[model samples]
Target: MELSQAEIEDLLSRAAKGQIVRTDFLDPAAASFTRDLLRNYPEVNYKVDGGYPSAERVRFAFFPIYVFPEDVELNIGFIEITGNFKFQTVTHRDFLGAIVGTGIKRDKVGDLILIPNGCQVVVDRDLVPYLIQQLDKVHRVSVKVKEIVREELLLPEAKTREIVAFVKSLRLDSVGASGFGISRSQMVKEIEGQKVRVNWKLQVKPSYEVAPGDVISLRGRGRVEVVEIAGVSKSGRNKVILRRYL
Candidate 1:
């Protein structure tokens, strides 16, 4: 992947401020051009995707480069992400599913990006600089996207008692409001009926651990994403923050 001196300098200047910015160009072809100009900078981070899903793929590569050290005190880092304009409605799931599975269906390189995990939906040739940016010790350039199938969703199974469990911890009704998008009573009833899953496994206990990668599917309601495990409450219960998608 190659970037122009101006684009490279722009990314470096922003990285100095600890801001993660996806390049505004939004062109995959620009990534190749940018990669050619990035050879002089060693402190910057970058990735490229070569083996994409389609032929009309804009001849673009997905590039995500992070400029934060692992041992840094802050949790955030600067990321310069670039991609070509493809289609919309492309969710983060589409990106991760492509990288970890049999690749995205039919659609060619849509330049998708999945957050939380920060995995890039990329083509085959653009994988080099990306690996260089993420790995610290070695400079192995050849890496392939391997597939691992999960017959069923796993982790982050929702339970009927989770509303009460979160309520018990924070003494707040927001969990009921934010999670189920319904009344607390409705949440209690739904959970008790064994309608949730934590990490793709059916979770019956309301107090089950809502770890990352868990998807909670409510029959009437929509899915909720357990984005992260923030921290423990003063009451000693697990504090799992979730984002429900309606």
Candidate 2:
């Protein structure tokens, strides 16, 4: 994660001012960068949330260390889109395009939660009105939109496939490919193409070693986490347990 020096300095300066600064929703890479940068300022307190549990992308808030408010709230809202639709037909990309088409910056938007009847979009509270007024359609389908309380939001249960594999070593590409059912040659190609990420940072080296608790994400293939390296197999191979998100 290559961040500009100016950006880090600006964030530090804002933290020093004792002001509550909220950043737009950041990708995993950017979020990691911000977390690393905040380490330099011990007096700055921060929190990261994405309006729901286990969200991949999230927003970060920086506050003064002395101000520890009990009920610090997030500036977020949910937009529920209702229409005649079928399950799995409307995707996150469709809803995102409609919102971005309304001139709302991508950073202002948070997670897009797809439900049985409709989809819920999390966004900056300030953009709720505009989104409600301007987001009229998604992919040419007329839709009705309404704001829902945070408590009313519904998240789908994550589906995962657990597998135990025997590998010669714990190299990232080798384990990831085995877990996700991709060929080693293809995994190397993907890594070289910059489509592989380890713990949110892009990893271009296929030979990069992985350990237990490491989260690996392959573009277009979903994510997986190393649950455990149980032990060595009788054939001198490593036994690894992986949970692949579906």
Candidate 3:
């Protein structure tokens, strides 16, 4: 679902008066809706940020047109959680459930990046202290959390592997199967089940044509991107190169 209309309207109203209004973290669909809403108010200056680069969840800040985005302060913080990983393993779900269990809205939290020692949580700077104090145990493993500066946040690099596919057409089912190393029949099932997203928007039609630079994602599966189309081959088939994210 998109952000609440009343909440957005309130932020816009206050932002029109030169006050900087900020929203909690939002997913892609919600961020898209907010971006569309802001287009109608050209007088409001806005910035979207997720504390670090390539953050999946981000927040929006709105201010008067006279104020520059850099002038607005963004209160985002990181917390490093260390525990006995050798004896017990902690996953994203475990850390997420533990933090959510502490009564904070999931929107208040951003990404939780796994590191060698443990996972680093991105959250609103104001909640750093509370999270460090309340978050003690994760997945039955005792843990310790400490506030870390923005510079210390460990963001992983995106790794992708190139895959080659020959299909009759650049249809979603054909190319997606090759990109994700799944069978065409399985790809069709995924699309029909509302588990496939093209560029983050759901695409149910298996026949949808995908172009270079388009990103296709299957829920629970990593993303696949069309890197290049090598044109028609001598066998009357199209050669495509896909980048599968790991």
TM per candidate: 0.28, 0.87, 0.84
Q: What are the per-residue Cα lDDT tens digits for candidate 1 across 21-91?
A: 33432243454446555564454554432323221123322223454333222111122122332333345
Residues 1-246, model 3: lDDT tens digits: 336867887898899887999998888667766877888788898888887878888888899999977899768888999988887877899999999999988989988899987899889899999988899988888889999988898889999899988899999999999988889999999999999998777899999999998889999898998999999999999999999999
Model number with the top lDDT:
3
2 versus 3: better TM-score goes to: 2
Q: How would you order the candidates by lDDT, starting with the best?
A: 3, 2, 1
Q: Once model 3 is optimally superposed onto the true structure by TM-score, how far is the C-alpha of residue 113 displaced, in angstroms?
A: 1.2
Looking at candidate 3, what is the lDDT of residue 161?
A: 93
Tens-digit lDDT string for candidate 2 (172-235): 8789889889888899999999999998889999999999988899999999999999999889
Residue 138 CA error for candidate 2 (Å)? 2.6
Every model: Cα RMSD to truth:
18.0, 2.8, 2.9
Q: In terms of lDDT, which candidate is stronger, 1 or 2?
A: 2
Better of 1 and 2 by TM-score: 2
| Residue ranges of candidate 3 with Cα displaced over 4 Å | 1-19, 36-41, 164-168, 228-240
List pairs with backbone clashes in candidate 2: none
Q: Worst 10-residue stretch by lDDT in candidate 1?
A: 71-80
Model 3 TM-score (2 dp): 0.84
